[model samples]
Target: MTIHSSHPFLPPPEDRDPVRRLRGRLPAPVSVWTSSNGPIRGGWTISSMLVADGDPGELVALVNEDADWWDLFRKTRLACVNVLASRQSRVSEVFARVAPSPGGPFRTGEWVDSAYGPRLADAAAWVGVRLVDADPEHSGWGLLVRARIESVDLAEGRIALQHLGGHYS
Candidate 1:
């Protein structure tokens, strides 16, 4: 499949750049994509997470073609997207680390296995999703997964987090 980029000079329908068009109209929510199992058989993390649909609890996330968590996700077919609170920037930093490994974030941290999946002990809230389908085109990304939410846990706190642009406030 061809993912097009939006052209600024053209009209809405004429715009070919999907990311640019999307950026102009939508504000993406930040989420840490996570999975389980590695050399130590623990958890993992990814940076791309998006809600695919509302009904039937659907969501979409992109995993890099070469990431370790991609393999785990392929096997388990399950994952958790942890939504961090404002005070949880440290958690994001931990997950965002490029060294060590993808599971680096959970190296020394605590987590709980939930009906949805594994959730960070400190996350404000989290949703569990079971892989329904995956489409990996030519983007070199592992695959774009459409998942069904299995369950949700909403913890107490004001939601605030940062993404590609900056902090969400």
Candidate 2:
């Protein structure tokens, strides 16, 4: 007799993970990570990432286990992090799957295939990385991908696109 759109097994907002709630309050930079396996290309908008400095700098990120970009990234073991500028939220929305694309997300913007992966044509800052390790992380329901920084291109400054409180800010 119950008619509703929400999944029965899905937890209510009040019952969700507290850790995730806390993390959501922390503003995270928004960027697009793109990868290609031969001719197959994919990109994803992401805000969960970190950088560790050492002999060889390492980039760490959490990715959805069931995304096209993740598939290409795993196969190629390479990616390019295109830091989205404040004025590029539309690009982010396209890659995030929150906005519709007539042809495809890639068609929304210009890109250049590089040794690392696909670079947003006008990305102010970008990083090329080679996969180092990937581990399963279930708490947030994502894979933890760690990569070594192979190349870095800084044109202007770090991007200002950010995500917080379950919204872009």
TM-score of candidate 1 against the unseen true structure: 0.66
Residue pair clashes in candidate 1? 4-18, 5-16, 5-17, 5-18, 6-16, 6-17, 65-142
RMSD of 2: 4.4
Could you tell me every candidate's TM-score relative to the true structure? 0.66, 0.83
Residue 113's C-alpha lDDT in candidate 2?
Answer: 89
Considering summed lDDT, which 10 consecutive residues are worst modelled in model 1? 38-47
Error of 2 at 139 (Å): 5.1
- Count clashes in each candidate, considering only residues at least 3 apart in sequence or on different chains: 7, 0
Model 2 C-alpha lDDT per residue in residues 23-118, reported as the tens digit of each score = 988988888999987788899988889889986999888888887788778778899999877777889999989999898999887888888888
lDDT by residue for model 1 (56-121), tens? 868766666666566666677778878776666666666555434354566535667654445777
Candidate No. with top TM-score = 2
Can you list the residue pairs that collide in candidate 2? none
